[model samples]
Target: MDAPERHPRIVVGVDGSDASIAALHAAGSLAGPLGATVEAWACWDVPPGYGLYLVVGIEGFEYAARQSLEQALADAFGPELPAFVHPRVVRGKASEQLIEGSRNASLLIVGRRGHGSLVLGSVSSACVSHAHCPVLVVHAPEEAAHRKKGSHARKSDDGQ
Candidate 1:
């Protein structure tokens, strides 16, 4: 029979952005020492007022989310993802799905602003405020994160 299931689970919210990639890496690095499994979630949904266009269905959005998740995983853990990492793509508000996932998780991890504004993202904020478990918000490395956000951060404040 299989070993008894571990109670430790790390749920990470990934949106294929640099920040999310950082979160995945963080979860991976921590999972082993903690004897936990990482669940990386990439969630997507149709924008408001796009119901007409979406009449065809939601497969496209779901597919894109899956692709993003895969790419992010590759970026985070290289070509071969860690065996302890279980990735998932779900259709719903990220914050809600992540919160729901946290119900049985020991930890919930999210990027500070993956595919979002400079400050704390709506999804991250919601997770911090409502997730059932402890939350860790990670920020991506400087260059990649800022580039994806459509801006840049100077290494020196003097504008060198």
Candidate 2:
């Protein structure tokens, strides 16, 4: 007979950023308590101009992106991990893919910004706006912590 179904499933978008790493950690912690499995998704899209001219085209880009996603998961999860976790990489608009993936998920997590971002990124904004499930926006730690650490470092450097 089949085994019993798992509890809540979480979907997290990982783009290999600090915020995304934090989100993944948060998701894993939450999953541990809830007996849930995490579906780590990384989305990519071909660049509009140069990408369109490539001989390998969008499919090749997507394949490479999937490999990158696997590498990111390996970096995050490391070896000798349990079997409950899953990772997927899809090629499409990040927001749309995440929203679709989270339809059956209990929660969705994503970083505030990813590569090629100068400000609050668009994907996080879109997921918060559109995800069917509860959304978690993992931001960097409080500025006060950084300030305290910086002050401590400066004081030590001055030897005072």
Clashes of each: 0, 0
Best by lDDT: 1
* Tens digits of per-residue lDDT for model 2, 20-103: 767777887888888899988888887777754477556776777777666667666776444667888877878899999988
lDDT of 1 by residue, 76-107 (tens): 99898888999998889899999999999999
Q: lDDT of candidate 2 vs native? A: 0.79
Q: What is the lDDT of residue 142 in candidate 1?
A: 88
Give the range of the ten consecutive residues with the poorest summed lDDT in model 2.
Answer: 112-121
Can you tell me which runs of candidate 1 are displaced by over 4 Å? 1-5, 114-118, 143-160
Model 2, residue 78: displacement in angstroms?
1.5
What is the Å distance of residue 105 in model 1 from its true position? 0.5
